[model samples]
Target chain A: MDKFLCGIDLGGTKINTVIITNKGEMVSSYTLPTLAHEGPEKVIQRMKETVYKVLEDAKLDVSDLEGIGVASPGPLDAKKGIVLNPPNLPGWIDITLAKILEDEFKIPVKLQNDANCAALAEYYFGAGNRTKNFVYITISTGIGGGAIIDGKLYDGANSNAAEFGHASINFDGEKCQCGSYGCFEMYASGTALANFAAKEIEKGRESVIKDIAKDGKITAKDVFEAYKMGDNLAKELIEREAFYLGVGIANIIMNYNPEVIALGGGVANGFDILYPIMIKTVEERCYKASFEGCKIVKAKLGQNSGAIGAAVLNIVFSKN
Target chain B: MDKFLCGIDLGGTKINTVIITNKGEMVSSYTLPTLAHEGPEKVIQRMKETVYKVLEDAKLDVSDLEGIGVASPGPLDAKKGIVLNPPNLPGWIDITLAKILEDEFKIPVKLQNDANCAALAEYYFGAGNRTKNFVYITISTGIGGGAIIDGKLYDGANSNAAEFGHASINFDGEKCQCGSYGCFEMYASGTALANFAAKEIEKGRESVIKDIAKDGKITAKDVFEAYKMGDNLAKELIEREAFYLGVGIANIIMNYNPEVIALGGGVANGFDILYPIMIKTVEERCYKASFEGCKIVKAKLGQNSGAIGAAVLNIVFSKN
Candidate 1:
């Protein structure tokens, strides 16, 4: 029997399930709206349905699968396979996701933080494949990170090693959701870009952004659009954001000196626009030797990276 | 026959040599003035004499040693065992101290940056002994750091990983020697503290520090002393320095989430005076979970940590 593994990427708005061969080639996939407003039980049922649908699409029996892996936003207890109350997903306090999935599927289940899954994906298939030591940073609504040292994930003493977003760029600057002031995320995340655009618009700056958002609800996409349209305010905001992001990256480079830094998530879709600026800023800030020859590249797996990486967790932890 | 190892710690003011048993127990140690003004050859000879004297003090012959390890300031090539233009040791550029020592001692020689040696010492015998992942930061005249991940030193791609001092805390802040602005070291190092004090004095701040150093030469020691005497200016300066240090530390804690953070060097000697303020600032800035149970302790090895750690290099590399 061809052994297969299942992976589920559970997000705030959706759940994606995929079944793959041992070699990591996906055989079938399924997706479902999370409807998290209905709560954990309903979400879990939807996840199960997606899993069953994926397996059915592959014409595979449950008995043919080796195990299941799940990737989700964290503060999660990965050892116990429980999801703690993540900021993005409310009312999810102390949910035993792994146990519930295991009980339903009668298969061993592994759970890891979503950012960690992305790092694993990068290590196994993305830019990180070229180096044993690297960091994967996903810049979306918020910045998230994972570290791969010696070709393995580095979970710190509390299983929360790479919280790169929370790293302070200014100790006495703006307040952050984590109750800190001047965290990198506060100044450089997609949310920060949106906030910057909104603030600029409110300051009476004339731009195409105001036309795109009649209700004054600015988004990162709108900022990028205005930037493309040659709005100076939008351009300046992105440049500033890239500068902060670059400083944060330089800090990471100095501290970890990873051979590669793989960038993922929605914001990285702007890599072409931001790469040169980020590179210039980072090069100017970090040690010359440490920055030399270090590869900074966009993540190749895109949205599927989490699911693909989650499936590979079985192989990774099994060895350990 | 029982094996022996030799370690040489090359410093700006002095050279320390120690003979140790294979088990890392120190058998004998000696120190000599670096006489850096006499140039590399003379200092190298003094280092050789100290090594031979220490071995003789231990009643051991040179042939009984397994290897020799030397720890020196970097901007050098460790793989080539060369000391390249270390700022403190003027006129010592591209000097192959390792090769010379190896030729003289007829044994294999290993070289490492002194900061890395301190980290290795901490990892093997000091505060980091129990933690597989930690960062060792030395806040002296300059800030330097080493990272120990999974029980091994992380040298990064160019053996320059863990340049913790270079990590930026503010993009437009003070300019550092490495040509960047707002580096952690620029705001947090002992030298930085003194610089802040000097700048304040120049600005006509009223303080007892003026009485202690009417000659216009200020040191971090003077600031600490003034703070002890309840000098408000000194207290404020120290508090501000501590705040920067704490923020830098919080940045590390959030980004790396190490199991422990070991503080070392002469500046760490004032840990008693600095600890509370630093901890308070970190508490205000860091994520709760990242710092919740993380241990921050003063390095236990004191001044000899570099030599001892260098001596242990054979064991660490061999075992790995």
Candidate 2:
């Protein structure tokens, strides 16, 4: 009888569950609405039911499972298995996720941060498979990252190593939501682009973005659309964002010297205008020796990366 | 017969060699003038002579040594064991130092960057001994650093991880020597402080630094001395330097989340005025979570760190 591994990616709005064999073959998978507004207990119950459904569809019993891995948003205490109060996931404070899952399924369980899970997945199956040291950066609503150094996850002193966006690119440029000054996310994240565009429109700069915005509010998608249509204001905003993004990438290269930097999340998903400029800026800024043979590429596993990476945790943890 | 290890630290002005037992007890040590003006071949010969002298003094034959390690300034290739053209050491491009020593003594020889060698020594015998994840920074004429992540030196994809000074603090602040804008070294290094003071004096700013300058050239020491005497110009200059240093430290914390940061090198040795302000700035700028339990302290290994760390390489390499 072949053993199976389970991985759960728990988010604010949804939960993704997958069961796979030790040989990297998928056995079963499913997703469910989190409905976190109903609170932690209900969410856990729904998650348990979804896991059971996945196991049943795969014709697997609970005892046949090797272990379970969970990837979730943090400020989490991975060692303690507690889900701390993440801004996006309300009422998840002090919840022992690994213990709850383990008790329900009678198997070992491990927990990891979502960005780290994506990096782990990429290291095993995506852009970083051929590289020993790499950084995975997600440039979505906010920038998040994970570093894989010397072929292992670099969980710092407290299991939180790569907070890339929080690193400052301009020490006095702007205030960040994290209560810091001039964070990389304030200049380069998807939300930063929208915010910049909104400010420009509000300042009465003439541009198509004013028309593209819905109800006097511009989204990152709307700004991207305006840039695609050759709006001057949008072009300047994106160019500035790409420039700062390049600075952040150069900083990462200088700091980690990773073999590859796999770019993911919405803003980095092959945004034609931003991608080339950002790459060029990184190459131009970082030390020549550090940049040599370092690759900056798009992430391959897409949305499935987090779930698959979380699931693979069982194999990594048990073996190491 | 007891086993022994050999370490060589090759610098522009001098060469240091030492022989030690497996237990890290120093058996013998010696230093020689490098006279690098005579070029790489002569420097290599001198290094060989120094190593033999140390061994002879210890009454050990070449066969008694486990391995040899050489630490030198880089842009070198650690894998190929070649010393590339480092700015400080002229005519050192592509010199295979390890192979030369290996051929001469018939022992395995390992090559490492000086900063990395110091980090390794500190990790095993100094400030970072208590923590698995730490960053070692040397701030003197310029800044350099290395990271130990997960109990091993993080050499990155190219054996050049943790170029901390090259990481930008303010992307548009100043043109740096590395062809980047606003690098940390440009703002916080000893050379940077001297250069900034020199420029300020040229701008006709009144200060005791102008009187302290030797032959109208302001040095960082002069600036520090003036600040100690309550010179307002020097005070403002030192404060700015400390603020930028703090920003750089905060950036390192956010990027690597190391358990501790050990600071060494000439400028950092006893810069009491800058230390408190720098630490405060780092605390003010970094996310509280990133700073939790993380320490910024003085490096304890002193000048022998490079040679000692290089010698210890045998133990680390053989075991891992």
Which prediction has the highest DockQ against the true structure?
2
Every model's TM-score: 0.96, 0.95
Residue pairs in clash, model 2? none
Residue A267 error, candidate 2, Å: 1.0
Please give, for residues B1-320, the per-residue lDDT of candidate 1 as tens digits.
76887888999999988887866688999999998999999999999999889988999888888888888988777778888788899899899888999899888888998999889888887889748888899999999988888888877776688888988888778778797888898898989999889888899899988788747788888899899999999989888877888998888887777889999987788888888899998888776777885788999988888898788777777776
The DockQ scores of all candidates, in the order shown, are 0.75, 0.79
What level of docking quality does candidate 2 show?
medium
lDDT string, candidate 1, A1-320, tens digits: 65898889999988988887877687998889889888899999999999899988999988888888999998888888999888767789999999999999998899999999889888887778748888999999999899998788887766687788988887668788888888888888999999988887788888888787658788888888888999888899889878877988998898888899989988888888988899999899887877884888899888888888788888788888
**TM-score of chain A, all candidates:** 0.97, 0.94
**In order, what lDDT does every prediction score?**
0.86, 0.86
* Candidate 2 structure quality by residue, lDDT tens digits, B139-203: 87888988888788888876789999899988887788788888999888899999999888889
Off by over 4 Å in 1: none
Candidate 2: list runs displaced more than 4 Å.
Answer: A213-216, B210-216
Tens digit of per-residue lDDT, candidate 2, span A238-269: 88888888999999999999889999888876
